[model samples]
Target chain A: MAVPSFLARERIVAKPGFNRWLIPPAALAVHLSIGQAYATSVYKVALVEHFNASLTEIGIIFSLAIVMLGVSAALFGTWVDKNGPRAAMATAAVFWSAGFIVGSLGIFTNQLWLVYLGYGVLGGIGLGIGYISPVSTLIKWFPDRPGLATGMAIMGFGGGAMVASPLSRQLMNWYDDDYTGAAGEVASGNSVGFLFLTLGLVYLVFMLFGAFIVRVPAADWRPHGFDPATVKQKSLVTTENVSANNAIKTPQFWLLWTVLFCNVTAGIGILEQAAPMIQDFFREGGTSAVAAAAAAGFVGLLSLFNMAGRFVWSSTSDYIGRKPIYMVYLGVGIVLYIGLATIGSSAVWLFVALAAVIISFYGGGFATVPAYLRDLFGTYQVGAIHGRLLTAWAAAGIAGPLIINGILDMQGEPGNLVASDYRPALFIMVGILAVGFVANLLIKPVAEKYFEPKPTDVPEAASTTGDRSLTR
Target chain B: MSTARTDDRGPQEGSKGLVAFAWTLVGIPLVYGLYNTVKAASALFTG
Candidate 1:
C-alpha cells in the first residue's frame, strides 16, 4: 500500500526558518484525539444497557485497550523512530478513526467482540503510536528545552479528556431521542452507533491536520540563541545518543522507569477514586455526606491541575534540571499523601488543595519523563525510549486502582467508611512516593559503557529512504 | 547522511499571515474545549 502523499517523509522535512512552534499544535492534535480514550467512561452506562452486559464485561474493553497500548508502544518504538513521526502519526490516525468506525458497526450489530476488536485492539495501536509521535520531533526542534516542548503536547492529552467528556455527553444527548424513557429501557443501538460515527470522523479531521502540518527539523538546525557547548554545562544532560535497545541495558533507564512507575501509582490512587474518596472522607456525623455533585467538581478541579502541571512543572524542569524536578514530584508527593492520610478530610478546602497538587505531580511525572530520557539518553531515539517508558503507565494504572479499591473494599462501602478507613491506603501511597524519591536520587549519569560508540558513516538501514535521523 | 540538502524555510519562517491562519484555525477547537470544561466544573457549585 502506498503512503499518503502528504505524509511522505521527504516532503514534510522542515525547511530553514520553518517555525518550530507550529509543531506543538500538531502534537496536540494527535494527542487530543487519542486522549479521547479517557472519556470512554462517559458512555459506560449507555453501553452496559445497550449490550445488556455486566459492568465488568464492558470494562474489559478498556482493559484490553490499555494493555494493548503498553504492548504496542514497546513493540513498535523502534519502528516509529526509524520511520519518523509523519508516518507514525498518519498511520495512527488511520487506525484510531477506523477503530471508532468499526466499533460503531459492532454497536449496530450488538456484537461485543467486534467492539473489543475495533476499539480495543485497533484503537490501542493508534494510542500507542499517537502518544509518542510528537516527542522526537518536538525535542529535535527545541533542543534547548525538551521538557517544555514535550509538556505542551502531553498536557494536551489531559485537556483532551476535559474537552471530550463534555463533548461526548452532548453528542450522546443529541443522538438519544428518548431521553425521558423507562428505567429498564435500553438506548437504540443506532443512537450509540451514530455518536461513534460522529466522533470517528471529527477526530480523523483533526488528526489529519496534525499529520500534514508536522515537519522534521533539519539535521543542522538549532535555535538562534542556542549553543551546543553551553548545554554541556549540565554534566548529566548528555549530548551523546543511545539507541533504544542499548538504553534498556543501562541501570539509569531502569531507575528512571521505577521512578515513573512509583510516581504514577501514587497519583493514580487519588485520581482513580477521587469522587468516592472525597465522599468517604467528608462524611459528616453519619448524617451529612459530601454531595455527589460537589465531589465531581473536585474531580474536575483535579483534571485542571493535572493539565496545568504538565505544562508548568515540565517547562520548569528545563531551568531546574530534570533530576531536581523529579525530586519535587517524589519528595513533595510523599508529604502531600501523608497529610491527606492523616487529616486532609478535616477541612474540605484542605482536601481539595492537597488532591489538586498530587494530581499535578501525576501529570508532571508523565510530561517530564520524556525530557528526563532526553537528558540521560540524548535525542537520537528519545521518542522510542519514551514509548518504552509508557509501559510504566499501563502498569501503574492497574496497580493504583487495585491498591486503593482493595483497601477501601475491605473497610465496607465507601460512604459509610470514615476518614480512618482511607488512612491505610493513603499511608501506603506515602511509602510508594518514598520509593520513587529514592529512585530519583539513584538516577546518576548513565554509564558510558552502554553508550553506542558514535559512527561517522550511515548504517545500511539508516541510509535507506527514511534517512531523517538526528545523526544526519 | 549529508547536511547538503537545500530545504530551508527562508528568513520569514512563520510569516505573520500564515501564523495567524494556523493559530486561529486550531484555536477554535481548543477555546471551545476550555469553555466546555468550565461549564461542567461549574455544575458542582451551582448544583
Candidate 2:
C-alpha cells in the first residue's frame, strides 16, 4: 500500500526559522539539568566521610535513583503523551526542584531517608518526566533527521555531566576550603550538602526556561521538500507505527532491551567507581594523589567523548542502519574489555582510550535507540515505548554496580588490585555484551500482526501520522 | 475583508530583510549563552 502524503512529509508544523532552533535548546534545558546525575561521583567522598558509610551504602543512592527513573517514566509516559509537552515539562520542573530542596533538608537533619526521598524518589521522578519530554517531541519536530534531532537532545544528557563534574568540584572547593584532600582523604558532608542546594537552584531555573519555551507544533506541519522514498532506501528503515503496548509484545523489544541493558551495565561498571578504580590500578606505579585527581579529570574527558558520540555516532546511524552501528558498539566493546583484562596495567593510556570508546558507545546506544524504534514501530506512542524500554536501563543500573562492587568486595584485598582480581567482572561484561550482540542479530522487521491501524473516527492527519513515519 | 485581501501581497523583497533581522535577534542570545557558559567554567577553573 502507498503511504499517505502527510506521513511522507516532515512532521513539524511550525513555520520555518525560529521554531527549528527553539526545539533543541528546550531539550537541552531539561537534559543538561538532569545530567547532574553523572556528576554524583564528586559527592561520593563527602558522603562517605559524613556517614562513615561503606562504598556499597553510597552506591545504593544512585542505583535507587536510576531504578526510580525507569519506573516513573513507564508510569507517567502515557500521561506525557496525553497531555501536551508543556504540562509534562512544567510538572517535571516542579518535582525536580522539590527533590533538591528535600535532599537539602535531609542533609541538614542528617537523615539518610530524607536524602533518599529527595534525591532518589523525587529527583528520579523528575528525571523520568524531564527525559521523555523532549525525546518524542524532537522526533516529531525533525522526523526527517530523527537521529540528529534525538542526538542533539541526548548529547545534552551526556555533556550535562561534563559541565556538572567540573562545576560541582569547583563549588565544593569554594563552599568549603580544602577541595583536595591532603594525603588521599575524602571531603566533609556539610560541604557536600551545600553543593547540592546550589545545583538544585541553578538547575531549577534552567529547566524552567526549557519548560517555558516548549510548544507542540501545529497539527498539519511537515518539513519543506521532504521525500519519503529518499528515506526508505536504507534497509533498517520502516514506515509502520507501533503503539507502546503492542511493542512490548514483540520479540524485538526484549532483544533491544538486552542490548541496552548490557551496554549500560558495562559502562557504569567503570563510571560508578572511576576515581577509586584508577587509583588502585595505578597506585603501584607511584601515581600520586594529584595523579588520581587528574585521572578523575580523564573521567570527565571521557564524558566529553561520550557526549560527542551521542550526537556524532548516533547521527551516523541515520545513514548506516541501526543494526550495523550496534555491531560496532558490541564488537569493539568486547575487544576493549578483553584488552583491559589481558594487558594488565602496563599501559594506562590504552585502557583509558578503550574505556573512552566504550563509554561513547554506551551514550550512543541511548541516543540512537529512539530512531531505531521509529524505524520499527513508527512514531505512534514511541515516547511511551521508549519509557518502557528504560526499564532495561534501571535493571542494568543496579546489576552493573552490584557486579563491579560485589566482586571487588569479595576479593577483600586493597591497594593496587592486580589484573587477576578484576578478571571475573571483566568477563561478566563481555558475556553480557555477547548476549546483546546475539539479540541484535535476531531482530527482524516488525511483523504486521503486532500493529493495529488507527481508528477511522480519528482525524486523518492526526491519527494517520500519529506513528511518526516522518522519522523513517 | 475584500480590501484586505486585495492589499495582501506575497512575500516581497522587504520580507527577506525581515527574516534576516529575526534570525539575528534569536541567534545572538543562543551564541552568547554558549559563550557565557564556557567563560564561567574557565574563570572558575583558572581563578
Candidate 3:
C-alpha cells in the first residue's frame, strides 16, 4: 500500500541543520498521549457501574488492548520500519483518537462490546504502532548514546499516566457537575463519554504534532566527534545487520525474550496488587495498620519510581553496557523479592522501599531493551525486532497478574489477607527472576550466519531489478 | 521539508529557538504530571 506523499519515508528525512535534540520531544508527545492507557483504573469503576457488568468483564477491555498491542506491533513491525516514523505516528494518532470516539459512543449507548472493539482493539493497534515508531529512529540518531535516547521516550510512557490521571479526573468532574472527583465518586456515564471524546480529540493533536515534527536522520548523518567503528568495540555490540525474520532464528533473540518476560512478570506481581499487597503486609488482627489513603499513596510512589527508572537506569546502561544492566535488574531483583516476601511486614518503610526499587528495575528493563536489541541486532530492522520482542511483554502481562492474583486467591479474600498470604507469590517471583537472570547470562552475540550479506555481494541483475528476493 | 546534505553546517540560529520551543512544549505537561504525582505520593510518608 502506498503511503500519502506527505507521510512518505523520503519526505521527512532530516536536513543537516536539524537538531537531534528535537527528536526526543516528538517521541515524548506520542508516548505520553498513549500512556493514558495505564490510567484506565480511574474510570474503571464508572464503566463497571454504567454497564452494570462484572469486574472481570470490564477488566477484559484492558487485557484485550494489551494483547492487541503485542499483536499489532508484531504484525505491523516491518511496515513501520519500511514506512518510517512519520507514517507510523500518524497512523497511530488516527486509530487512537478514533478508539476514544468509538468507545465514547459505546459508553453513551451503554454497549460494553463497542468499548472493547474500539478501545481494546483499535486503540490498542495505535498503542503498538506508536510504541515502536520512535525507538529505532532514536537509536540511529543517538548511536553515541542509544540507551539515553530510547530511555527518554520510554520514560514518557511511564509518565503518561501521571498526566492522564489528574487530567481525566478534572475533565470528568467538569462534564458531570454532580461528580466532585472525590475518592469514591463515580462519574456519570455521560461524563466519561464526554471525557473520552475530549481526550480523543486532544491526543489526536499531540500525536499529529509528534508525527509532523518527527524526521529520520539522513543516511550519512553522524554526530560530530563520533566514530561508528568505536561502537563495535563493546562486547555483544555488532556492526552487522540482521533482518527481522532471521533475528527470531537466533538463540540470542529468544534469550532476550525470556529475559524480558521474567523481568516484566516479576514487576507486574508487585504492580498488579500494589495497593492490597501493601495493606496485607501490615495487617494486624483483621484490620491493617496502613490506611487506605496511605496505600493509594504507595501506588503513586511506585509510578514515580517506575518512570524515573526508565531514564536513570537506561541512561546508566550507556556507561556500564546493556548486559551488565540486565544482570542488575534481574539478579538484584531476586534478592529484593526475597526480602519483600520474608521481612516486608517488619516495617512499612522497608516494604515500600523494596517494592519501589523492584518496580524501577521493571521499568528499566523496558527502557533498556531497545538499546540491547541495537547492540545484538544492529539498526537495520531494530524497530521490527523490538516490535516482535514486545510479545514477551504481552505474555508477561497475563502471566504476572495470574501468578499474583491466583496465589492471593488461594490464601484468602483480599481484604482479610495477612503478610504470610503474600509469601507464596513473592517467592514465585524470585524463581521467575532467577530464570531471567540465567537467560541474560546465556545471551551471546548473534552468530555470523544470521548476519545480512553486504551489498557488494548482490548479483548485478538482482540489484538492477530492485529484487530483494534474489539477494535473500 | 527543505533539502540539505548531511555534510552541511550545523543547526542555524533560527532552528535553535524552534528546538527550545519544542522541548518546552513537551516539558510543561510532564512537569505538571510529576508535580501531581509527588503531591499524591507525599501521603505515603505523611499519612
Best to worst by DockQ, what's the order? Answer: 3, 1, 2
**True-structure lDDT of candidate 1:** 0.83
Tens-place lDDT digits, model 2, residues A1-472: 2222332322323333334556777787788778878768768767867877787787777767777889988988766765546666767777888888888787777887888889888998999988887888788777788999899888878767666765776777877787663435456687788888898888888887676666555443456555667777777577666778899999998989999888889988977766566556655554433254455556555666677789988899877878998988888889888887777366666666777788889889999998888887776678888899999888888899899989988875666565567778888889988988898898888888877563433443454234332321
Off by over 4 Å in 2: A1-18, A48-58, A177-191, A279-290, A344-346, A410-412, A455-472, B1-47
Residue B22: error of model 3 in Å?
1.3
lDDT score for residue A268 of model 3? 91
Select the stronger candidate by DockQ from 1 and 3.
3
Colliding residue pairs in candidate 3: none
- Cα deviation at A434, candidate 3, in Å, is 0.4
Pick by DockQ: which candidate is best?
3
Task: Estimate, for each residue in B1-47, the C-alpha lDDT of model 1 and write its tens digit.
Answer: 45444333444734556656666766676677777666656655674
Models, CA RMSD each: 3.0, 7.2, 3.0
Q: lDDT by residue for model 3 over A86-169, one digit each (tens)?
A: 999999999999999999999998899999999999999999999999998899889999999999999999999999999999
Point out the worst 10-residue segment of candidate 2 chain B by lDDT.
B1-10
Best by lDDT: 3
Error of 1 at A223 (Å): 0.9
TM-score computed on alpha carbons, candidate 2: 0.82
Every candidate's lDDT: 0.83, 0.73, 0.91
What stretches of model 1 exceed 4 Å from their correct place?
Answer: A1-6, A180-188, A457-472, B1-14, B43-47
